[model samples]
Target: MQTPPDRRSFLKTTTAAAAGAALTSTIARSANAAGSDEIRFVLVGCGGRGTGAAAQIFNTKGNVKLVAVADAFAANAERALKSLSRGENESKVDVPPEQVFAGLDAYKAAIDVDADLVIIATPPGYKPQQFEYAVNKGRHIFMEKPVATDAAGVRRVLASVEESKKKELMVAIGLQRRHEPTYMETIARIHDGAIGDVISQQVYWNGGGIWYRNRTADQTEMAFQTNNWYHFNWVCGDQICEQHIHNLDVGCWVKGMYPVECNGMGGREQRMGGDASKSQIFDHTFCEYTFPDGTKMFSQGRHLAGGWNHVGEHVQGTKGTANPGGWIKGEKDWEFSGKKVNGHQQEQHDLIEALMRGEIYNEGEYGAHSTFTAILGREACYSGKVVKWDELLETGTELAPGIDDFTIDSEVPVSARPDENGLYPVPVPGKHNPFA
Candidate 1:
């Protein structure tokens, strides 16, 4: 494995002086206030993952406080706040009802509050906009994975990454596997030649099914889709980008490069009782990705019940084989025997510690690129044609145009109404124009 480049070397000389001065000031303040000063943060999107991330932050060593919270729904924000205001986290949380915001634009209010960090766990569709806002505010960020739902959104995130680096802000994405001790040890060895020259890989996120929320009689089309985001393409990007991205990301990490081309097949096999009206996303996908080095990665992602279930990655190398999560199977086999840690919790710990040390590390670039990789596979499966990284990224359709101005009463980009047969339109291979 090649030695990782020093992050400082990539700093722009034009901004080097300013960045250096900022870093020095930050280091001194952080070092002096380590355990004394409060590190306040705001939460945007009070869903399950958002709540969990807040809990982890409270567990970190420091004087951290949850200053504000926001969600598309008021109930979600309230519920998350109630959950956090229990046991050990209760004292650390300072959010009052006034600071708990709701509605599509609520994130702006929460982010506007005085805070050192912002945690974004919104649906993938909302991430790019929210992330750009956080960076503009000059707040550190800890955002969830699959940074975007479409190539357009990925482009937006990539742009924000540059601004964040210029400001020397610390940005951590929720690809927690990179922070897991076991995965770290195993991948380090792979890069060190334990799994010499990875040739092929197999990754899977095959699972049973996901939760579905029935549209209530009083709910608007936008409300209904937001409630059941997992079933929508505009918001969720299907299961491939939503859930299967982790495994695909591991494949890319082992190869140290993104796939150049991909083709695949997928459809809504057993989803919503085979009714397309209820869901616009595919339930199963099989993607064949070709890396720039000509290596292939066979990817599988399924949501059908009673099928084989798997959620890991495997790699084949010239000199050996490896399960990048922890083990190598050739040229002196080895296993990770380190203390197992919860990646979700560990990631928070790492971010907070690095902030105290004033060390800036931005994961946004790879996060956006890996997300686009998943989008590439999804497009291939949807179009039933080979898709190249550059072409799709340059011409792919935006999943939600004018997303920055969305409101609760705004019409959704994808219709929720059913056809005469009570079926929603599902993407048909060979007919879907991914770049349209």
Candidate 2:
């Protein structure tokens, strides 16, 4: 019955209360004489990725503290917290057993605590609702990449973005590539026409790794797993929306707008284990998305790990092109190669600086826009037809429910819905909001 934080209030604070001298050194909060401006945190997920973010915060200035922690499993959360405390995070974490909230509503318990920052590090399936609450509370957020798994989850995030802008809140999404200086500088060149008139481009995410599947018998259906979120179409919305979203986000960064349309094709020819619990996501997918002005971008995401195809992006232009992941081309043969840049740190550092500076930063918009671009690729792959962005988004078919309340079959698409074979939901294109 509680209305979430006002997005406008969230947006307004970014420029107001946050920009003082305390924010000057964004990487680490400089300890003050009084040590007063404490940025307490509540980590919602304890997976490797979530732990990585927690560690980053530790390496950063000790201005913020990990006060409380939560997860689906108490052991996992405590493990992560203990690891942090034993290592560099000992001085920062003050969470007692009682403060360590767990279970489905763990996210809520963490956010409701007295804290300055909220790290929404859970699965993509649970992002919208927690993010919504964090915004309402006017908390600074360090959210992971790929904001949502489907269009419906996205619509709510889009709304949240607008509210964040109005409130001046500093919202950092997980897409760390955008914060990297090399990538930012390179993109500026492309926009400056260094590559001449831009044309279509190609990008890839390929390699070898373990296959995604259902959890073992010991885990409940609600128990979380990395591979499970990867396979469940409703949860991960196919590889295109989940992993490949980074490339799609880059495509949006290059095009400077949400894609106009996408046509894609995919097949689950591999990874045919019977343990695929209600999961029918693709093993591989290739999509072509066009911008409003007719600029084209091609994306190829392959799951056949350890293959000859390495990962990168190629931007074609009359003057030549630049490939992300450190490849490049030129018209008169002008060329420059880059060493691998650490993007995660770049984005994290930027967020720290933004928070300290109290700059008006919000990932809600850019993240939502880029995520929807990724979903366009998924919708196209599922429907077997070319889909227009304006139309697909118009249906208001949210993948994750706007709210977190779920009662057995509570009509929430954020996670999954069983198919005839007892598999989770697949994208039903014709339906108004199949995921929800």
Candidate 3:
């Protein structure tokens, strides 16, 4: 069995190699060369989001080309390529049939292709390994958030961030809200004291539901779970880390700090037709996160249908209150009336523009930290205990142990098979040990 590479050992080896060679100058020259020519990129996970991201890259103002693409299933890769080759995106996409890869190890082959950027939109559990590989290859990255499915994964990304900085790689995490004009203006005001002395905050991702894929007779357990990754803890990190991360990230952005400690409660209800066996995740979670200054942020995320739903962030300070989406209701009320742009598209533009100008920006560190914040909240909810940030990060269980060795036929930690009572082992609040 092969586990993830140890961060310390990897860093030690890479650092020693870097010192012996002109790696820094060589990478700088490569980035400069890319700026002058068409920036070639590869897509590692060709799902809907990955395909959309590749489209956005084509839409970016640049001489850019898609060189390769990969996915866990060959169908998805073919479909994404077909979709991208239609109409306007056709000329921009140049991936041949030979460049299309499938299976668990497909990401490595895609990354090994001749490309300047790697777009990683795989399941969160695989992100750490993929990111480390990209950084080692000295490729700029744009990976979707949340970055990881567990604390161990978070630590892995954090370690990779350092190496990326040393390589001057431009990394972008898909927390697109940070790139939106409305959010950028509104958060700037909050930071500038429009909402004076931030004291408390609230964020949400309460929604109706998400899609579920039924197991097919031909599919193995690993393939089934990978296809329907959201319901499993080891891959998706539940709804909190997946869907709710946007709001939680906004909360942290507004406060300008990550939570020091958090205690949360969550349980599965009204999910998978009310059958616990179908999902290993909670449909609803409420978390109270405390900052170092004693200020608190309250978080609510639910997937239950027919409930009052909200999907935004709010900050309450000494002088006033604000909605980070676009407005402030403080001493002097204000609303944004600026030119609005699609954040999803804008983020790609920023990355491309920055690379062309030779300005390297690495969003990986903050992105990893915010991701860990969500993981902390999830663990707190699972264990029904106050989970401190440092403790959980340093010594939490690896959700997908020996993840690098996983194949379509390999066994997942959480079994898809049901017990005699036809129930899966959903986490019990008092008994679930996230650290074990």
Candidate 4:
């Protein structure tokens, strides 16, 4: 398809605008002082990310225990259970054969278990409602990133955020970049203006592509979307929210605030009409985020074949620029900007300790803002124009396909042709782009 003029210009201006928007936002963190110990956990999603996170949480000390498991697929739940450490500590798990749940309401099944904490590791589409359920039941939570696929879902998460704080529930989102010590130290320095007045930053997460392959004849869009939830817009919120959200979160962390507006571009670069099931989400997205203090974040993410060696953050100022790992370069030349950096292990362990010590802790509001920062940039890239964070914050577009019944016919198409005219809704802002 020929490049549309509107789209072309949108891409061009976005690049220029990014020259000054770096490190304008940092994730707001809340870690209450240590209190009395004892916290149990229930994992809702059991895919690789979920299981891997479970492992990290396990390594955390101070009265933390995994108790239950739940997934839409039986195999997923079983996989999570099997991968966990088996000992007297893990032996008290509430998930036996009868306790493991598989179904649309698997989260409820897991939440119904006798546990004090829950992990919403399922697809983002279900995160809001599941989180609400967990919060209502009064449980501390450790949810994966991309809080919700759409604005309303975010609203739901925000609602839960309020209640969880009221109950003093310990809620942590799995934006592990916050846990990566190298980035943390670098960000602290940037905030301290070690590089002088911050000017801009460039963050990229590009690769040859991730799990987007053809589905067999036996697989339907519904089945494929549910199983490969990370690739579905309604489920994972695209690469921007799923993968790039990390970079966005880093931007938020470095800037010490949230972006006010964003402009971007995204499309199905490699997989257009091949098959709806193979890949239904945008493969690449480039966005310019303008934060409250006029800092810029040149955020970019791509899954194209043979792309750049990626996955890092760079904060720039009048003095220097550095990757999250403390690699800094400027007129003074490259200098390792080592600071106090900690990984997910330490972060989770600290949170658990805080919980045990009865310290105030909550990942609700701060995590939501960071998650939306990524989502807003995504909406910009999707629509080929700037979008206000306010609009995104109140957006009601829902990608959550609440399918009551799953069958081949009930599947949502993931890919399509733009027709002979090469036309499709490309996430334009403010006019109710109803293409979802």
Local accuracy of candidate 4 as per-residue lDDT tens digits, 157-263: 88888887676676777776665556655565665567776778888888766765355678655666677676666767788888788887776666666678888
Per-candidate RMSD, Å: 4.7, 5.9, 6.1, 8.6
What lDDT, from 0 to 1, does candidate 1 have? 0.83
The total number of steric clashes, by the backbone 3 Å criterion, in model 2 comes to 33
Q: What are the TM-scores, per candidate, against the unseen true structure?
A: 0.92, 0.84, 0.92, 0.80
**Candidate 1 global Cα RMSD:** 4.7
lDDT of 1 at 243: 85
Better of 2 and 4 by TM-score: 2
Residue pairs clashing in model 3 are none
Question: lDDT of each prediction vs. the true structure?
Answer: 0.83, 0.66, 0.84, 0.66
Q: Model 3: per-residue lDDT, tens digit, 100-149?
A: 99999999999999889999999898899999999999899999998998
Q: On residues 1-436, what C-alpha lDDT tens digit does candidate 1 reach at each position? A: 0111122332221111211122333532232223557788999999999999999999999678999999999999999999999997889999877999999899999999888899999999989999999989888889998899988899899899898888878778888887787877787788788978899999999999899999899888788888888888888888988889999888887777778789999987798888777889888999999987688999999999999999999999999999988989997999999998898998888788777666766777777877888999999999999998888888888878999999988988853345678676678999999887
Using TM-score as the yardstick, the better of models 1 and 4 is 1
- Model 2 agreement with the true structure over 1-436: per-residue lDDT tens digits: 0111232432232222222321232323222213466667778888778888887877665476788888867777888888878855688888888888777678888888887777888777678777888888777788886778766677778788677656656678887777664566566577667777767878777655444454576665545333366666555666776678787777666655556788887766554543345455766778888776687899888776445565666788788778654434564433335554566665666666555444535666666777777788877776667877777776635554543664222453534655556665444444423223
Full candidate order by lDDT, most accurate first: 3, 1, 4, 2
Q: Where does candidate 1 stray beyond 4 Å? A: 1-36, 414-422
Q: Is 2 or 3 the stronger prediction by TM-score?
A: 3
* Candidate 2 whole-model C-alpha lDDT, 0 to 1: 0.66
Worst 10 residues of 3 by lDDT: 15-24
